[model samples]
Target: MSKIAQELASASTNTEDFYADLKPFANFEQLTNFDRYLPLPDDWFIGVADVVQSTRAIEIGRYKAVNTVAAAVLVAITNALPRLGFPYVFGGDGATVALPGKYLDDVRYELARTAAWAEDSLGLVLRVTIVPVSEIRAAGHDVRVARYAASENVSYAMFTGGGVAWAETQLKKGEFAIHRAPLDAKPNLSGLYCGFGPIPTEQGVILSIIALPLEDQASYRALVADVLTLIEFSSRRSGHPLPEGGPLPSWLGGEIQRLLSRDSPHANLLTAAADALRAIKTRIVLAAGIRIGRFEPSKYRREMWQNTDFRKFDDGLKMTVDCSPEIAEAIEARLIFAERSGVCLAGTHRQKSAHLTCYVPSNIQSDHVHFVDGADGGYAAAAAKKRRVRLPRGTNGHYRANRSIDAGERPHRD
Candidate 1:
């Protein structure tokens, strides 16, 4: 009816108030039955950043490092172009961000820098690719998307139509692989943090799972609904899945306050130094527990909320959860049941604690978000588990039967 809707239906991407239109469907109640998300216009781009040979890295105990690289791309890009708004979805190994055409060059600069840093600092092969939306449409796919606001301060971009997936496939195939640049400076990752280890909980356990859908959207949606119902019950019986006191310890907040320089990458020496001074001052204030310029625990908590990059939807459903032991058991049972009943392909992993990686904006104490995954292995491991299921394909074209370990079968998490 309206121009935006018309453009969306016709595969034209518009970021202007994009999430506002989808706010009504942000929660599971409406999203499970919604018609479809909007499609992107030709004037947009899709970026996929990931660690090459990530599975091998995970196997070799570099899983957390891999996550750093994944969130690093988003942090670098967003910091580089703060004025331009975009939507991003985090995969445990990498991330997918969509934005208008104007941000492409800046995005490339940051991605190159990030890839270089991953290789240089972390010894991980980070791959990045940026392709125009038109290229995807030409390949006979669409990048339909929805905004899922998990909390009041956080919203993730969910994708359908297979275009975003196609782009990722291309990147994996080395078709559009953007390589690392030889830069003297590291990617601007000032506020990113990993000093705090996994938050301890009573009977602490992290549950990671992936559920792939068949073509029948309703069936898959229903399956997600079932999973949510279990989680809701568990939350009522136990506490919220997120850490209750927001990852304890007095020095924790200070440990995460990074000094960021907001001067333009092209700024003069004087401006750069001034920005650096400002950053150090802010970090000192935050680290010392002084509340100036909205720099306090409440603000930090919101930053964490905005960046809770655990639950996401792409070709499959993925999440890294922390819950009470009993709750974890009940949720696992439901996944097994869903798979056995032909709802979707199921892949799951259980661990002691969830992994956390952060992306703090140029401001040390504000505009930060934390990404979470299962500690030993997160989404990447779960997806690997899903791939091993040699089950019969159901009518929905998904691998049938659940491959999740029975709660009693393994005590690896316990």
Candidate 2:
């Protein structure tokens, strides 16, 4: 057999490990480089969980709740495969994770469970879909991925090749609706938190924005860079919009302390006592700046600052920006220019407080990571706006299928 044939055979086998071992890209400076991407194996699958009609949900002021339910899928799946190292990216309204066929059934089961949990506990509708790499390829695309280390503890997944993008469209178009099945497991969400509110900037307001590429536009990345500048937000700040170590706000600590518990405040005596003790201890160490094993607040903050998932590109640019009202106006002006230039479409929301969602390894010191989004209506709102704007048509008939996104479909249900 030819060497290329042999390589293709190997690629079909060690799917996840292949990309996991590829050198991780370092910063936004190299965002446009295509060689960094490694092809996903045909034996793997990509799972997406997005809140249906999230724009409407955000309008009703349930953005924080929406963020949690969307991130809940990641927390659940990681816990299920604690020892495995896979790639996942957090979106304000949902999440995307990829793994090999070996874990397909387990991951799907988790998706079902997460979907049900979102609807039942959170009163939000979640549409989940799992598409095989073969299916992605059959649709004339490949799932390529690269790992980007945002910091010492946070390494995010970056995807390209238009495969995952196609899968998302297929999902929205109802192509994969038959794959959804009944789910019965309860998600393990111990580390998720909405306790902290938005960080106020006398600047004006905090904006959650999502920007998608304009078909045939010169460079979406450059357009996003301009948008960030107008907002006076340095792409340098980490993707986490909130600083949880408590230098900014203190009074909110009491409410946050209560929300940290896993059990109800009205639970029986013993449970309540234990919950209270744990909450207090967590607050003291985190707030008082105590150093425990790997719980150094200062170092973690630095890492978060350097390695946030904001200003990231995975077919589009989605970020949480803290902008003053003046800066917001400037941003609008720039966006209008870009829109007239037929360059990009953006959705933005200004609100108070930021939401934090976490994926805790059974061993917290290992590979735990947290995701953050704007409080009321983060990138979800931004994405909603982007959705309404028509996708630009490529000069060559466009890479996207002809159909518009089926915004009303529930792709996760069988």
Best by TM-score: 2
Candidate 2 — worst ten consecutive residues by lDDT sum?
Answer: 390-399
Give each model's whole-structure lDDT.
Answer: 0.64, 0.61
RMSD of 1: 7.0
Using lDDT as the measure, which candidate wins?
Answer: 1
All candidates: CA RMSD (Å): 7.0, 4.8
Superposed by TM-score, candidate 2 places the C-alpha of residue 93 at a distance from the truth, in angstroms, of: 1.5
Pairs of colliding residues, candidate 2: 150-307, 197-353, 198-353, 198-354, 203-324, 204-324, 204-325, 239-308, 347-382
